[model samples]
Target: MSEVTDLVEMLEKTGIPMSNELIEALLRTEPSDFTDFPLESFWHDFPVPFLVTDSGVTKTISAPHMIVTMLHHLELDEGLHVLLMGSKGGYLATLIDIICGHGGKVTIIEPHDEIAEHTSNVLERRKQCGLIRVLGKEALEDPAWDRDVDRVLFTGSIREIPDFVELLIEEGGFILGPFGGRIQQRLMKKEWQGGAWLETDLGGVVFGPMDIRESERGFPDPLFIADEFEDALILISSVLGENSEEVYRLERLVESLRELPPGLPEITSSFTEEEIIEHPVIELLMTEAEWLNELWPTFVDILGFDLEGIVPDLEEPLFGKRHADFTP
Candidate 1:
């Protein structure tokens, strides 16, 4: 308690817009209650990764700063329903559940299987968060999210508003998340008004590259990018066996990526983002970026696209919503 209290004070001193109610509510539980991450991690103002692999850090509890920024912007209070995407290892959900209280509901949709399992274990172990429900992509068949909610938070980054907002939310309330490209983005708040959503850029933020696999750069390395280019084409060709100049052109792009030092002595060039489409599941992605919205739904299930890869550039999240089973 002392350590977390000190951490909150530090955040306040740094001008985090934490209200007395939130601070007091948060103190009732600890980050440890939700995650087995190191205790020292809970005392800092940095993201604490709970899920990691050779693919890189797939998920993390938002740093204290980001957490407070989101909480303040969310305008959370008792009895407001909140829909959250991604578990953040259950830490953020726990806080939201506390703030919303017994009368309120906090529904979390965690796309990753392991992450969702971890969060469910955490919630089950910590019985205090009685108002929260964590649902994985499979359980999503029940359409629980279709209900009205006061707010929606995408823990990972997104490029556009989720399509479901039209039917899931009335012409009122807010949707908050970081929106933009995989490399850069800003927190955006969309307020429903006059049967339309008015957008506001809250501030710049570095969000989850949300790619299932990544290197130092959230995007795959140059060589891997080439491999994926080849993979995407193959997947498309597998589905639509017809060949064309566009396929040939894309094949050449893949070859260019594969162009390494001709000899063991070796040479290579760094591929720019433009040359390398960033999302990890390129093979699963539509070969033609322009046709994604149209092709995504019919093809994604066959590709087995999952929640872990959220596919930042994907326009329609519905196609990207298949329950995830990752490569070992």
Candidate 2:
């Protein structure tokens, strides 16, 4: 088998599912194009988070799992305009260039000067300069930065969404990022709709914080809170008994939700109220409602939304309960 095929099979063996399309993308691209280290060392599925420097200061490249998961959330396509808030050695950005192919365009904003310069040099050498634009850190703070993108992905965590980001996305465009404080962080997806931003939780994620200076310029209220509800449920279920039928059911439900397509409406519309409350996952959460109630309010307060209104309550019997309670 080819090295790419071997890598794909190895990842699958480790329980990281890979769609054929994603496999093809990886197969066609070279890891050395992004990583400073030898690609042979990463021939198998492995956690490869590492530090690189542009001018003696250190910056991080995220782990492979996080990169793949974020890409899955982006649901990229040819010709789409994408904006990336952070460039970590330009590894993920290069992978995106491979997927977007010829027609797509990528605009990247990197805060560190040396890192951006290094990334630009690499892209130019790889003949990908035509596909991507690397901008200075101050560009994001500029009111005039392009905001017509179809998709946005943040490589780092942030306490609140940046105002410029909100203005940059075209209607129906979505942004994905690990959002929350150091103690709690979850990957959040937000889309612009009619004039408001609708948000959803894509489960938990751990990422480093955004540059402190940039984060200070973010909006007052984050659109969504970091969600750890499902994680809590899993822990609670395990303590209750790992082999129980209910625990198995909850595990399946969590997996299903994690693999669901991005966007709040797409996920919420897929299931009915009967399908939701009756699901083992929902039942498990309800059984531990008192515990969840204690945790839910803090998330609700951070998001500035009513948790009860968003989630389906046993008392409410709503249609989008699955999304309402857990995601947004």
Winner by TM-score: 1
lDDT digits (tens) for residues 306-326 of candidate 2: 434324555633222222234
Q: After superposition, how far is residue 94 of candidate 1 from its true place, in Å?
A: 1.2
lDDT of 1 at 287: 44
lDDT of each: 0.65, 0.64
lDDT of 1 at 31: 76
Off by over 4 Å in 2: 1-3, 14-19, 38-51, 54-57, 141-144, 212-328
- Angstrom error of the Cα, residue 138, model 1: value is 4.2
Model 2, C-alpha of 288: deviation from truth (Å): 38
What does the lDDT come to for candidate 1?
A: 0.65
TM-scores of all candidate predictions against the true structure = 0.63, 0.60
